[model samples]
Target chain A: MSLITPEFGLLFWQTLIFLLLLLLLAKFAWKPILGSLKEREDSIDNALKMAQQAKEEMQNLKAGNEKLLADARKERDQMLKEGQAMAAQFVEQAKTTASAEAGRITQQAREAIQQEKNAALAEVKNTAAQLSVDIAERLLRRELADPTAQQKLVDEYLKDVKLN
Target chain B: MKRLLTLLLCLCTFVGFAAEPAESGEKGGAFNPGEIILHHVADSHEWHWFSTDNGNFVTYLPIIAYQPGKGVAAFSSEKVAEGKTYGNFKLEDEKLVAIDGSKVYDFSITKNVAALAMSSLLLVFIFSSVAKSYRSRVGQAPSGLQSLLEPFIVFIRDEVGKKSIGPKYERYMPYLLTVFFFIWFNNLLGLTPGAANLSGNIAVTMALAVVTLLITLFSANKNYWGHIFAPPGVPWPLYIIMVPVELIGVLVKPFSLMIRLFANITAGHIIILSFISLIFIFRSAATGLISVPFGLFISLLELLVSILQAYIFTLLTAMYIGGAVEEHHHEEEHGHGEDFGTAEQRAGGSNVAHLNRPDVATH
Candidate 1:
């Protein structure tokens, strides 16, 4: 190495130049650059905000869908209950009408039987009276015809009849 | 006009005092080019007496001596007198050697280095305070330091981290922020007088570059290695040729980072010093007067560059980290035939017989 080293003249000048260049950049260039960076940051914030909003909207839509589904289920259940009640009511009405019709048919059947019995009874009474009248007529006729003969026959029959 | 006249009077006095010819036998009072450069750039710790408080309490500014052989030396202007025994001062072996009877001392001061250290500490304090503010307000809008740092934080997150490193970038944010702030703070400090040449030192830049290199090497995934070695779709011969080149590329990346920072910073300093040196070189009072305006203009320009260099350095570092940590994906052809038959056939004896049979099946 040389006894007298070269002074840092070059280094000093270089450093000064670099510093001046830096100052220029700070004044003129940095504003635009930093501004761009800030813009980028703002955009990122907006994106995050948008994402949060979308998530909230999705949650709201899900809740709404669930509510709609629940309402539809409730309506279906109500319709089902009404339909069941109507069906039960129709069944009860049909049962009552069927029972009433059966009662009427049974009464009619009993009346028909009673009428037939009454008719038969009336015929039997008429027949019995007619038969008795006919027999009485024949017997009287026989007695009248035999009266002259009967006096002689009676005298003979009287001796055969006991006096008690 | 009065300020200007006073400034002119001062310049005339300084020139007259500095340019006085030496004794006939001694060399003329001419400063060497090397001495001139060192006087401007080197650190000094001595207290120069400047009158500010009407000479009640003298203000002291550091003055660096333009030692011929020695790099730079600190001498108190207050202590300097006209031929007052010149005691305890010795130039030995081209270095400023001081001998106080039996004790020897080197006239070097650590004040500039301390200033640089203190500047770094200040950066730490400011950033930490900003971070604390952010933490305290969980959901509220940012204010004060939070407002200032929030923009930078988000920019790094979205532009540097997200765009460069993609989704899995949160883990690297701390390192990026630290690097960005550290470099930026150091660069700004270097612009101040009597501060350590942190970024200008090649060793410091090398250390930073090494950190980036280590991170890149260790964090590199299998895909990165695969790309370097085999390089998808590249012919085997070409890939063999490219492997060493790609490996060398890894080393070159950090080397470039080291050089870029070191060169840029050192160049700026040299340019500024050169402009200032013009004043002494002309020796003409008129030339020196003309140079003052130009020097002021250059000083203004250097202020802007101080921030730009910092930004450029940080951006490049981010890009390098991004490249290292990025994920790569490859798509395979859908209908390619299988290289091997079914496992059973490959394992069985009948498959061995079929393997021996040639084109008889084709006929």
Candidate 2:
């Protein structure tokens, strides 16, 4: 059996065929196949990397948005506090002015009442003097009842005035 | 109905063709199992599918021989039917030797060559179709044969090429893919009834290995040869011992590549043929029960082995070339050669082994 024996004919033919097949396949089949395979693999890698980057960017954006929201909330609280303090200040100023005006008005009323009291006493004195005079005059007029008696009284009064 | 009739007719025709061979082979004699197995595995100058009672069926291939005096003696192999002579040349001891005891150079298209041709044509047709599909169906789900072959193509590239060869895998990919399909298809062809044992032939294996060796050697950078001749981290006195050792390894690598494929394919064929021969040796109808099932089991195993062998061959080729052309930076980055993964470690990885690799998985 020539089983283990390496024949020259088969060896030559096989080599020729193998080389030819390798060259032809390399040009036609493998070139395109390998090219496409590489193309697909590279694209897949790119897409994965891009997805990872996008995820990171999304996380960053979320954090930034939170920070912005915090800032806006802080500014709003500051504004509200300032607004409340201004309102309290206006209330305090209005109370002070109103108290001053009320005090001045009360004092003026007291002075007017004092002046009216003095005037009322004076009027009472005048009324009392006029009442005494009217009473004396009524009594004298009753005592001297006739006209002759009145004339003798006038002469006696003139003499008495001269002696005085 | 017409399709059905045609199918039935084809089935009948095949049965007729198949049936006649057994009857003639019986007349031919109870087959010697070992010889029969060897005959199937060897190269031949004719293509014999089967035989009939009237006459044996064979497609006589062309005989191409070159002798010193005759220059070139080319003729149809039919001239040497039953080992006849033509122009002082005859098939002597299964070789195209001159009848006058002169040396002759035979570069004939034997049965294995025919197998190679057939497989090549088939490969071209199949791959071109897949290529066209790839071109037209970019980014879409693969359908038909494209779907079937795409995963394998991707596996060879990623697992075998990218894993073992690292970044420079693309350069060697064309040759890798070519050899992968070539060996794979030929191995498959060998399994078919009436097909030549293409990958089983030692010549075919040697040719493929030679190509790998040539590619590896040619692409080898200074670092590769340097390491082989004078390895780093070894004592200076050890160069005397290590240089030859490393050199033998360089020689042995391709030798192993050749033998592994040849032995594996040849063994599978021998086993299958032996199983088939058992039925004939026993000469009992009942023997089919013992023979057919065993043969089938072995054949099915061969189906996996054939593809596996092809993958191994291509993967090793990539690793070799990867080692050769590897930039020194790669080893530095990975720490060392063996640290990346020994060839044995890579072998344990089946066709889908890339799925398990942490690096490949990340990709």
Candidate 3:
């Protein structure tokens, strides 16, 4: 039947037209369209990958920053401890030097006072001896001066002196 | 949807009336639905839209015929109107025939040819511009026609191409996309009243199937040939039967592709025409109640089928290509090679099963 039959003319035209359409569309339509579609997809995928990488890099930088802060904090703590220790050491050294100087000054003053006291006591003893000696000499000289008067009396006492 | 239904209803009514008197007066004293349906479904030398008492509205195409000794004769089909003889040639049963018993080769540009050319141009224009927009838009969101057509292209690329054809899908994208759109567009175009049933024509579908077959056979790798000739784990003694079966499977795939599309489209047209023919057969105004609504329903269903058949064709094409180029893993060959062979057998077998099953009401 003509219903199922395929005429040569129609077949010829169908084949020719279909092939031409395929060739034309392949070169003109499908190539560029599919190419751009692929390019867009690749670019989108690349962008996502780059975004992931950037996020990771940001996290790394944050972690590095936190580590640096911690290190600085540790250094500050160590420095504060070292500074307190040095200040404590300086205070101890100053206290020891001040106490040592105070002891030396007190000992020197005590020695000076003792030497002054000895010197004054010796001078007082020497003056007192000289004064006693002058006073005794003066009293003896006065008694000798009274000896002439007594000589007359001695004539009376010659006999007693001779007897002595 | 309503609008389209109304338009379809008017067109179907117009077509039914046009063919009624012409068929009844020319053939018998009664209407012939078969003649009307076949006339509508088959290719013709002219594009007939409607007929009235005044004259018939048609476009006469160029008729080119060649005889072995007489050489080529070119003339407008209009010259052979009303069964008139033009030179030694005349129209006989919608064919250009030689008068003197000489063999004639008709190379006429029929209604289908013109429609094919028009659809081809339309395809070219739509896609070339979309391609241009892709160039211009570059990283921007698709707009208008680009956005509209992008999903279909991507669907064919992803669902039909990648999912069906695998990694080697890219190479077949052009052919796949072209065939899909070509079939889809023509199927929709054919649904409109009295339009040339270009997609429904056997010759057109045959050409498409042949191309798919050629591509499948040519692009097929060593693995495909191996499966066909040796069938992997099959006993060599069974090659006498298995080889022929495998080879028949190869030819049957494309043959079915051709017939499936041709039959489906042509059937749809026949069904709609038959529904419209009911009113005249009964010769009653009351038949309008039954005819119009049923015709409308079928036409709307046809809209869905047009795209569906196109998708099925392309999907199966992708599957065939995928099967052909598929590689056998070295591990599978040594360990579970028999199972692997049976798996391949199941795939090929299921496809044939799908083919043999009746299409039911969907077609």
Answer with 2 or 3, whichever has the higher TM-score: 2
lDDT of candidate 3 over B1-363, digit per residue (tens): 245236334423222111223423534576777887898899998778887665567767778899998898877777775688899999988988878868989988788987887788889989999999999999988888999999999999988887766546788999999999999999999998778999999999989999999999998999999988999888999999999999999999999999999999999999999988888889888998999999999999999999999999999999899888776665433332212233444467775654443221122
Report the number of the highest-TM-score candidate.
2
Give one digit per residue, the lDDT tens place, for model 2 in A138-161.
Answer: 645864687676677656655654
Docking class of 3: medium
Native contacts kept, each candidate: 0.00, 0.64, 0.93
| Model 1: share of real contacts kept | 0.00
> What is the Cα-based lDDT of residue B134 in candidate 2?
76
Q: A40-159, model 1: which lDDT tens digit per residue?
A: 556779989999999999999999999999999999999999999999999999999999999999999999989989988888867765665565456556665777765665555455
What does DockQ come to for candidate 1?
A: 0.02
Candidate 2, clashing residue pairs? none
Q: Is candidate 1 or candidate 2 better by lDDT?
A: 2
- DockQ sort, best first: 3, 2, 1
lDDT of each: 0.55, 0.78, 0.83
Q: Place model 1 in a CAPRI quality band.
A: incorrect
The lDDT leader among the candidates is 3
Q: Which stretches of candidate 2 lie over 4 Å from their true place?
A: A41-100, A114-164, B1-30, B52-54, B138-142, B329-363
The positional error of residue A131 in candidate 2, measured at the CA in angstroms, is: 11
Question: lDDT of candidate 3 vs native?
Answer: 0.83
